[model samples]
Target: MHRFKTLIIEDEPAIRKELEWMVTQKEELALTAVADSVAKALDLLAQTTPDLVLMDIQLEDGTAFDILHHHPSPAFRIIFITAYDHYAIRAIRYGALDYLLKPIDQQDFNGAIERLKKQEVAGLPGRLDIARQMAIPEKAVDMNAQICIAATDCLQMIRLADVMHLSGEGAYTKIFLQQGKRITASKPLKYYEELLPGENFIRPHQSYIVNRQYIDKYLKSGILVMRDQTEIPVATRRKEFIINCLTTLK
Candidate 1:
């Protein structure tokens, strides 16, 4: 019986140990390398070409996306491990990639491993591209990065810099982009609030989240004047928080 050479990339000490133990339990798997940060992971990758990579989404230095970006076409299969990051998990699922949430369940881990053993590496690059585009970084929010938006007819990839504002309409979100382009996303405003980088985006009202870069001015009468000339109301409770965020930007 041939054992699959596996590489573990995780930062948390407890989880890392648990994963190592779990991998040891699997007779088909052989733990080849373990890395706690992006730098170490990269160094290990340069040295070893493992059959499978168990990667955590966020590391001390950077994200798993950074690692993926570095190696655009990796030979090994990947099973992403992350916390309850709605956007990251959603992106992985959207890409049809395997992911195990934190506090890893034994059954789920077994299932993901079984699936990986059965599947082929065909179309991995395309799936990875989709995952990279849609996965949001937990620490650094890059304004220039592109995010995948699920529209009614199709999935649209929109750059974070091009987004002007987001408005909530019941369960859906209406994304206002540059040059008067708008897209109705299947997800709600709260989903975007969590996904978007807080440094560039702010929730001035429950119904609206505006990009700080596109704000023309803040009115004294509890309103925001956008560069596109759209007036968005400010919630009474969020007024102080919004003002503080804007002040820091200036």
Candidate 2:
């Protein structure tokens, strides 16, 4: 009898530990490699395609959304474990196979496991059919899952594509957008570097990744001028790259 080898993709340390406990408590299931973030999970999946993946919807790097793109399982079976309530019902109705909400009971878990066993006899849904249709909300791009920004005393909605530049101060990243609107968030520049859409932004200074579309003008001395006349001090190291980026325009 082959055991159901499971891989857990979760960011929270305590949560990951509990998942390991859940899998081990079952006689028919065995725990496999655990990943702390989506990138690590993607790498591990390339090497060891587990029979089942227990995923947390919210992750440090991004959401468990990318997993659905794999369709059934890559190895394809997926069980979403989320704290958010509404997504649970959506997960099941959308043919996700199953979901386990937080504060998980042993009985509910055992039931899901039994369902997994039952599905094996019936054959699982072909994940390929659903994987092809995974489309994100397209109004504003949020590939990194960084949505709301805290500005002054209020939190404001933001789209990654609308942000024109990220300027790093001591501990905060000042986000400059296309409409001459600027906001500051408590997150660091390194955090934005990981969260921003990579191709659309280019770092010309230690404090900046000027959005390519918003570069109003560049002078002979390599100073960047925004449409609103906000002068961005470009780093000496990034002169050529910035020049090339501006010069190669259609």
Q: Model 1 over residues 37-86: C-alpha lDDT tens digits?
A: 99999999999989999999989999998998888888899999999887
Regions more than 4 Å wrong, model 1 = 1-81, 85-100, 103-140
lDDT of candidates 1 onward, in order: 0.87, 0.68
Error of 2 at 216 (Å): 59
At residue 64, candidate 1 shows an lDDT of 94
Q: TM-scores for all candidates?
A: 0.58, 0.48
Please give the lDDT score at residue 69 for candidate 1. 86
TM-score of 2: 0.48
Clashing residue pairs in candidate 2 are 71-127, 72-76, 72-127, 73-76
lDDT of 2 by residue, 55-158 (tens): 88778887776655544435446677777554333333223346787866678889988867755422234432322222232334333333445455444556
Clash pairs for candidate 1? none
Candidate 2 local accuracy as lDDT?
0.68
Question: Model 2: runs farther than 4 Å from truth?
Answer: 70-73, 121-250
Which TM-score value belongs to model 1? Answer: 0.58
